[model samples]
Target: MVDAHETFVIIGGGLAGAKAAETLRAEGFTGRVIIIGDERDHPYERPPLSKGYLAGSKERDSVFVHPPAWYAQAEIELHLGEPAVDINRETRSVTLGDGTTIQYDALLLATGAEPRRLDVPGTRLAGVHHLRRLAHADQLRGMLTRLGRENGQLVVAGAGWIGLEVAAAARHYGAEVTVIEPNPSPLHGVLGPEMGGLFTQLHAEHGVRFHFGSGITEILGQDGQVLAVRTDDGEEHPAHGVLVAIGAAPRTALAASAGLEIDPATGGVSVDAALRTADPAIFAAGDAAAFWHPTLGTRLRVEHWANALNGGPAAARSMLGQEVSYDRLPYFFSDQYELGMEYSGWAPPGSYDQVVCRGDVGKPEFIAFWLKEGRVLAGMNVNVWDVTDRIQQLIRNGTTVDAERLADPTTPLPE
Candidate 1:
């Protein structure tokens, strides 16, 4: 049992840190808990920043995980805009950016990640932007609203979730968007070919142009303003503004400098099943921690909102000496140009021998199941959310269902 005065220091005031503090209090720890984040605002949801928040449909406070007053009520001290500059494992203390060190009985490193910058010339121009923070989204929204054309051309440099979601928001404002992907289709590197094909056709139907198999060599600009994007094919595409969404790397400098073990394979901090690092006094979670998956038998690092919110409490329990392990059934959702897509479970590499499609793909309403050696590996639902619950259950129980029944469209995947 922990004493009431034992101080718990949590770095990174994102979803994971906030939830950890809440969980500690809920479990009757009553220790002095503090959350330190680099962002000035209260911890907010990143998913909305690309979708509703970027579309001007919501306010800044709408994305906050909890209001400012909530922190005071919970007695969880929040060090907003203050980042942990250094860590002393021997002393068990964390030095803040303002040059103050705090001792702690336990520490949670949820520093999250920053936007990966592009290396090409003219990337430093004014109109070139990356959406990772709420402030960034606000600036992007203003830029899009200022463009003021019914079919304004907005060029996206990557086809990741953030890029696609921003494209959907731009299209909502009647902007003619072009997505330039190095791959043949969106999400090809992550979801494979067939699933990415569905997204390609879906966007094309909504009047979004795709420049597939093309790489941006340079982002040319005039007078500190982005003017056009030049591809490796020597074709210059006119773009009012360019968005780089090439993904992010783990922010592990503080922990690494403290002599923490980082996994070379995933570039994430190595954590045990209990979310603890090499030092039992320290732990990590969210986008910065990588753990081995029991099902896939490979290290997994998921960058999704579900992982932060769900995995946060699990890490908190482990830090409090509870034996809970964070082996969640992974799930992610994406919205693009009026299409809703969701996926669950780890899709093993080269696992699917047969893919059964239920319902019509052309109508934009269907579900596809990947079967590996007569067992379910992963499933994707387009507009069908009814069967997702059952599909999730089937995945949990490792139930094998009839492949023929899956294709009938009338009968969903069995539970």
Candidate 2:
């Protein structure tokens, strides 16, 4: 029943778009498949950009989603370094930067996101870096290695995940690291002060400095090279380099211009559970999609690796007219020094009633749960092995258990 004449087009070079094309071919779709990418490099996973790759623990080839030859073998039409400039819904066509327009039977927008640049002065100076692309990682890696040899300092802006991860990598390279955050604690937006304190302690114990309640006011440079970064706290930290890890903003201009429905709350292309937009032929997934999650009963736009790894395939099946319900919870993992943590589900600061931790906080090995009215909303495991499946199950089932039992290490999660 497959139609060899149908054409499916994807607009992103990231993991989401690449995986979606793979899924389509795997599902026996003999039709034309095309993927448009703005970046020159082939699609690659992003986690190692700030973690293993940045820390020199992984090779450059390891970051790619697939071998270069795989795309050609799969018969995927790739337009590398060419950005899709316009999406004309009337003709179901997309215009490239080179002025070539391609017609498609179905389209997917996985444009992904870009790192938010600091609005402070002297940001254009050399040695002020950000890690979003593979080239950035390559540059940062060299800088860290040189800084380690020269005994230079690295001032990191924003104590979010990126800031912390890069700070850890800087320390791993034997460079002095200082993290500046505007909030009272690190990761304040997601984990709140209770859990954020743990990371603050972890970094401090490893010789990393934290300047809480501070924001970058300006970056001072001489001869077009970074000298130091000044903070709002009226302090100037000397730095040979600076890493701006403020966060990322999803790229939504293209979708909005196409008159596609975008979720105002998340600034993402609004789509149903099947990842289909207002126009049946157009779909979206990955970071650009603010999709209706059937299980959570709310719209979510996740920017983690797992979402794209799974979201792409789900969108592919839906494009093939399969009944798809994308209800997977938001999940992410981090590596900082000796501590490795995996957090599942979403429980923002004000949404959770209390955070309960099981096991030894001193050993820094435990599982923490964010509960709302005794119902588990999120769970994080630090240095603890396995148990992710059970944690996700508790969230999916909305399980309510006694506080005492939930906190006790001896109590096994019931089936």
Q: Which digits, one per residue and each the tens of the lDDT, describe model 1 over residues 1-415?
A: 3455688889988888888888988988888898989989898888888988888788878998888899889888888898889999889999988998899999998888888888889888887889988889988887777663545578899997888888878877777788999998898776778778888887787778899898899998888888899999998988888889988889989889999989998888888777889899998888898876665566777778888897778788888999976777678888776688888877754757877788888887988777876677778888877666777776666767778876787663552
For model 1, what is the error of residue 132's alpha carbon versus the real structure, in angstroms, after optimal superposition? 0.9
lDDT of 2 at 57: 86
How far off is model 1, as Cα RMSD? 2.0
Among all windows of ten consecutive residues in candidate 2, which has the lowest summed lDDT?
A: 1-10
Clashes of 1: 0
Residues 388-408, candidate 2, lDDT per residue (tens digit)? 999999899986778789899
For model 2 the TM-score comes to 0.98
Q: Candidate 1: list runs displaced more than 4 Å.
A: 1-4, 149-151, 348-351
Model 1 alpha-carbon miss at residue 142, Å? 1.0
Residue 261 lDDT in model 1?
A: 89
Error of 1 at 183 (Å): 0.5
Clashes per candidate, residues 3 or more apart or on different chains: 0, 0
- lDDT agreement with native, every candidate: 0.83, 0.93
